[model samples]
Target chain A: MTQTLGITVDNISVTYSNSRLALYNASCYVQPGSITALVGPNGGGKSTLFKSIMGFLEPNQGQVDISGLPIHKAQKKQLVAYVPQADEVDWNFPVSVWDVVMMGRYGYMNLFRIPSSKDRRLVKESLTRVDMMDFKDRQIGELSGGQKKRAFLARALAQEAKIMLLDEPFTGVDVKTEKAIIDLLLQLKDSGHTILISTHDLASISTFCDRVILLNQTILASGKTEAVFTEENLAMTFGGIPTIRNEERGTRNKEEKISTIGFD
Target chain B: MILDWITEPLQYGFMVKALWVSAFVGIVCAVLSCYITLKGWSLMGDAVSHAVVPGVVVAYALGIPFAVGAFLFGFGATVAIGYVKENTRLKEDAVIGVVFTGFFAFGLVLSTKIPSNIDLFHILFGNVLGISQEDIIQTLIAGFITLLVILLRRKDLLLFCFDPNHAKAIGLNTKFMYYTLLLVLALTIVTALQTAGIILVVAMLVTPGATAYLLSDRFERMLAISVGTSLLSSILGVYSSYYLDAPTGACIVVLLTLLFIAAMIFAPKYGLLRRSHSTIESN
Candidate 1:
């Protein structure tokens, strides 16, 4: 069951030390027990926003709170889980799928403490939920792109995090994998888990996402998917929508070039 | 016959000490090298090892323990590289190259200024056979401490090396992990000083883990393989040195290099002759 809590981001702004302004007075509240899709064009500050919420990159102004608690306080209680951009990770790291999943439990235990049976059971269950139980013994590097994404989801699932943030989870995933992930997110949301996913797959956004936050160097609009994901907003989000409205069809795989910059 | 072959090297006390010091050096280096290779910090290892030369030489002149000097320079080099990398527009590799070279040059110049009795060559090229009891004790203690820390924080370090973003997301101190590794690297270099010396210690820190990486996809297997290769190379290096009448450190490094070549040809996935994948991850 999910005990998802709302995330409150005040008028936070982030400017890197190099004077690069990544986010400008971005503010939004992620409603509890709902799935929110963070949609943005390339270099539109989606990942930066995610990092800010995860307490990875601090905001120069304002603060982020989880259910009225500071981000670090919530994180110390293991209240948040994050799945980074798949490309940001080194897949060739010498770890088994099982080992990777076990890393989720690192937050629950103290340093040098071995994983207990409870942790082991959770890892197995999480892998089974992601349809990666059979691949538990396999190396993470040996997995296909879809399998790799599933493994990451499994790791996040094992965190038992009330608030989950996924960045570009469906970038290179297969249709089957994407469908499975959407189903999982829906199911998690139903259980009251707060899920934030950064993605470009607009087709799925209309289907599963309860809320959509359109970002372009800032939060463009955030509300019900149908309410916020209109033609005007899409145009503004991706610089006139490129004569298209996000064409990530059933054709899945990284090699299948997405209709990028708003349309193919 | 097997007994005699094994017992022959056990005859001399110097050989015994050589083998003993190399064993500790091999295992510790192998263990720490896994993290080093995973994080792509081979150059850091090189930088720290070379930077410690002046520290060791200075410690000798100042009547301090060489480890204090080595550790200071090693840690200093790490901070300098980090500072240069952050403060300037230069890339990490460029910063590493510039900072490490400067420290090494400083070390070389300082070596000339020190009394010749300090024997800087021994620091550059190890004299494992001439290792005093004190050196042996220091290597063992330092290796033990460093290896202990690595083992204790294995998963945290592993996660940090693989995905620092996720590590920080999970509330683990990413900076602490980064510097802890540097701390371990410095300790390992000092432990390896009497056996591999400054120049060869980098080889010990990189070759073992890289070889193991070629052999396995799982981290546990990689650890076993790395430790096995390192210990095997140590024994063979010392044994061959006795027979070939060559230097122990050179022989160990040569043996390690030969093993790496063998792995390059025979490694199931990444080997030159056996490359099965079109584009493999370069560990």
Candidate 2:
């Protein structure tokens, strides 16, 4: 049976260390076997949301669940995988792509036991899925930016997780790499895996993702792709002219009144 | 003449002990240095090494094992640096600088004030020629434990140092991994004490792995290369010291430094002279 996990974020809020900066308050559900894009501006708390979901940061209030179990609990069962931003990785560290992909299988085996044949086969298969089998022996640093992203995706796929969280997988990657990633993601969704990607780039939302969560430090809107991805929602998420015009109106009115008075 | 040079050192029990002792320190430090270089913790290693000076003095005053004091203050300095970085706005470099300088100064003051029969220069610069049998056994045991732990957990530490977030996401105990590396570092420093001393410990901890990193892009090869450099340098340093009438510790450091310079000039793809980036940029 191909089991999939649905994600639930119930009133999650985060604050910065004994400070008044309430980074975000979010509530959304990501259905199983679908691609949900977390859309927001830079510093719009997108990465913060991803961090909280991955259990790296403790949310001030609320819970994240995958298929009715808590995030950590689901994680302990080897049901979740996360691909960090490419820039966050240490490219200079000496490791091969095969070893990097093998890292995903670490959670399945107990300490001291070598990876089994089945596990090794899965790692090979994961690389094949991402078209990186040829580069398995290559050191990760030797790969190009796009190839690096593909290898990272292979690592995540090798996890065999029901839920995958990718942060900025498309950022700085070329068009072909992005298309390859999209194709692999669609294949995953077909095989009953849930994937949530957090990115600032909105262009890929309509094409690659089936759902959208528009965010600006808080949940502005979220639903099926066609229902929630509106001009107004995007305007709000990107701080487009509508929101900027409101502040502009106040200054413009004041200037007009001063000119009408016609005095130095 | 070279045959006499090699046989003369083997004649004395102490010289034989020092050679084996230096080799043990070289192997452990070389292995641990792979992670240190990868994690960009060279300065941190230097800081922790100097920070242990007061601990050694205090342990001597209190009549406890010097390793205990070194471990306590080594971990303490790391924690203090981390605390200062988190609680205040100080960057890691600044925090490390302030805490290490303060601790090192405190150690110096304690060394001067206490009237102990221990040679302060020996404590600072090491006296490999004078290490006792018990000291050799301790270094052997410490080196064994460190090597065992690091080898058993090599994959985990590699992932943790390379990408901690990915490690944690994959259910590795990154906190445990972080502290384990620190503990290994402290233990490795303890092992290097009698041979390298506190002053030369940083060199043993950082130089070999750094040289190896420039030479290879595979961690396994890097380890082999690092251990090879460390063992070669230590043996050469100990051997040349007798004929040159120089301190064993200083001799080891000078050899390691010369090797580092050589690696920088001649390393395969990344060498200063053979780099491809410069050619590409020129085009």
- Top DockQ hit: 1
How high a TM-score does candidate 2 get? 0.91
Q: By DockQ thresholds, what CAPRI class is model 1?
A: medium
Residue pairs in collision within model 1: none
lDDT of 2 by residue, A1-264 (tens): 233488888888998765644455589998898999998877778888888888888898988877787777777777889998887888887889999999888888778537999889999999999899999999998899889988989888889887899999988889888888889899889989899998766767898799998877888999998998888778777767345656765777777757745852
Error of 2 at A173 (Å): 2.8
Candidate 1's TM-score: 0.91
Which runs of model 1 end up more than 4 angstroms from their true locations?
A1-4, A16-20, A244-264, B1-9, B276-283
DockQ of each: 0.57, 0.51
Residue-level lDDT of model 2, residues B61-143, one tens digit each, is: 89877777877888889888888988897678999999999998998899889866668788789888898776677677778
